[model samples]
Structures are given as structure tokens and as C-alpha cells.
Target: MNFPSKILEKSVEEISQLPGIGKRTALRLALHLLEVPKNQADNLANSISQLVHNIKHCKECNNLSDTEVCIICGNSFRDDKTICVVEDVRDVMAIENTHQYQGKYHVLGGRISPMEGISASDLCIFPLLERIKEKQVVEIIFALSATIEGDTTMFYLYKLMKDLKIKFTTIARGIGVGDELEYTDELTLIRSLQNRVPYSQDLI
Candidate 1:
């Protein structure tokens, strides 16, 4: 597509790089931004800059945070003995919205996907193991998405931690076989959390 201005073309190019955004969508967004007020665009630019530069992962659970420890990890009322393991910060937000769980969380950063060349070493698994060793963790609730990669990740984690004497459980299958945790409704997520079952190799 040809643009009258190189600046608009550059904006479209940059915006198109974002996930799920096509070139046409990016062009429309660029035009929309151009039509918006100057300060509104400036605010959008500033927020994006802040998101990239100011955000840091929580040292404890690997969740995105402004501080070393995320609010969930730092909360005194959260259950320290039980930790819900999730794929990313988005899953954390999804579960938090349900308000059905009171345990701490461990974000694996991402799941193991051999097709994507993402291995166990590519994730925050080491920090999670270290956290388990340091904390009085008794139960691990696998809150990963109900996808193949999610199942693979949970099984791998189970194999690694089976010798640690901690109880292993997984969220119920109410979220659907291929559903992502982030996209599940709050009611379904709440029920899944409430009806979690023991994690066994046979279930995979």
C-alpha cells in the first residue's frame, strides 16, 4: 500500500508488528490516531514508552510489576503454602478477577513448545524451583491453559517436582480442552479452581 506521507507509512509498519494486527488494521489505526487530538496521541505514545521501559518482572513469581515483588506475592493475606502455577501474567489477571483463589502464584513466563523452539531453559522454571525450595510450599495447583502445550508443561513440571513431597493438582476440565485460561469466563474459571483434582500421569 502507498501512503502520501512516509511518517504514516512508518507508523503503520511499527503498529503492524504487534500480534494479531494486520497491515490494513495498522493503517486504519494510524489514520485514526492522526485524526485524534495531539495530546491524546502523545499520551498513547508516552504510555507505550512507559510500558516498555518502566515495567519489570516480579522477582518472586516472574509476573510483570513496577516493583521487585508483585502485589500478590507481597500480600500478607495470601496463602504461602499453596501456589498456583500459570503460563503468564495474563492468566494471573484472569484468576485474580475470579476472586476464588487465595494462594500465591508462579508465572512460568511461557509453556514448552518444541515447534516454537521454546525449551524448559527458555522459561522461568529455575526461579520457580528455587521459590519452592525456599518457601514452605505444600501444594502446587497447575492453572495452565487446557491445551497440548499446557498439558506438556504440567507433566514436565510434575516429573521435575514429584520427588519434592508436595501435593500436585490441576484445575478441572471445565475450561474446555483447547481453551486458554485468559479467555475463559470468570464463572468457569471459578468453578475450575474450586473443583481442581489431583494431577496424575494417566490424566494427560
Candidate 2:
């Protein structure tokens, strides 16, 4: 398709390269940006550019931050002894949204996927191990996605630390707190973290 302006074509091409954005949508977005005030467009471009240039990973947890340490890792109140291992900064955000976890996090950068040419060394695994040892981490909760790649990565880490006397656990997998049992999906039902009452007398 021919664009009326080469500049518009270039804008569409760049925007279309973003994930989940097709050329048609990119074209529409480019056109929409044209309707906006020049300063607003400039501000959008400037913010993206500034983020690209200034974004830094937290030296401690690999969380995206503008400083050497992310706000979570730098916090004094969070449980420093328990580290939640996740695949990326996005996973960190997802867990944070739950508001239930109070431990620190270790971003693995990505799971080990040979098909994608990603390996353990390519991730932040070594730094994570270093943190565990240096920080005397007492427990590690694997918060990775319930995928083959996620499992493969977790297994590899488990093997490496199995003899270290550190406790290991995974996030509870089950129905959401609000969902009824009848509406619950099968996989969640199968892998449910159900348990009997710890102190049955307390239920009375």
C-alpha cells in the first residue's frame, strides 16, 4: 500500500514493528498522532527515547529501574530472606499486583529455551546464586510460569542448589479466591495446592 507521505510511511513501518501491532493499526496510530498537538507527539517520542536511553536494571534483582537498586530490593521492610524467582520484570509486576507477597524478587531475564537460543548463562542466574549466598537467602519460591521452559529452568536451578540446605517451594496453584469449585478449570483442580486443616481442632 502506498502512503501519501514517505514520512508517514516511515512512522507506520516503525510502529508496526512493535509486537501485536499490525501495519493497518500502525497506520491508524500514525494518522491519529498527526491529529494530536505537535507538542504531545513530541512528548511521546521524547519519553520513549528517554526511557530507552536511561532505563537500567536493578543491580540486585534485575528489576527495571533508573538506579543501581530497585525500590523493592532497597526497601528495609520486605522479607529479604525469601526470594521469589521469576522469568522477567513483567512477572515481578504481575506478582506485585497480588499484594500478598512480601519477599524480594530475582528476575532470571528469561527461561532456558534452546529453541530460542536462550541458555542459563544468558540469564541472570549466576547473579541470583551470588545473591542467595551473599545475602543468606533462607528460602526460594519459584514463581515461574507453569510452562515447559519455566519448569526446565526451575529444575536446573533446583539441581544446582539441592544440597545447599536452602528450602525450596513454588507458588500455590489453584482456583482464584473468588471462583466457585464448579466453575474451576481442570488443570488448576489437578495441580491444586489443597491441604487438610493444619490444626483440625481450630476449625470447631
Q: Which predicted model would earn the best lDDT?
A: 1
- How close is each model in CA RMSD to the real structure? 7.1, 2.7
TM-score of each: 0.84, 0.89
Q: Across residues 1-204, which tens digit of lDDT does each residue of candidate 2 receive?
A: 788899999999999999999999999999899999999999999999999999999999998998999999999999999999999989999989999899999998999999999998998888888899998999999999888899899999999989887999987666777789898878778776463236676544
lDDT of 1 by residue, 16-43 (tens): 9999999999999998998999999999
- Give the per-residue Cα lDDT of candidate 2 at 161: 89
Which candidate should be chosen as best, given TM-score against the real structure?
Answer: 2
Model 2 residue 84 lDDT score: 97
Give the lowest summed-lDDT range of ten residues in model 1.
170-179
The per-candidate count of clashes, in order, stands at 0, 0
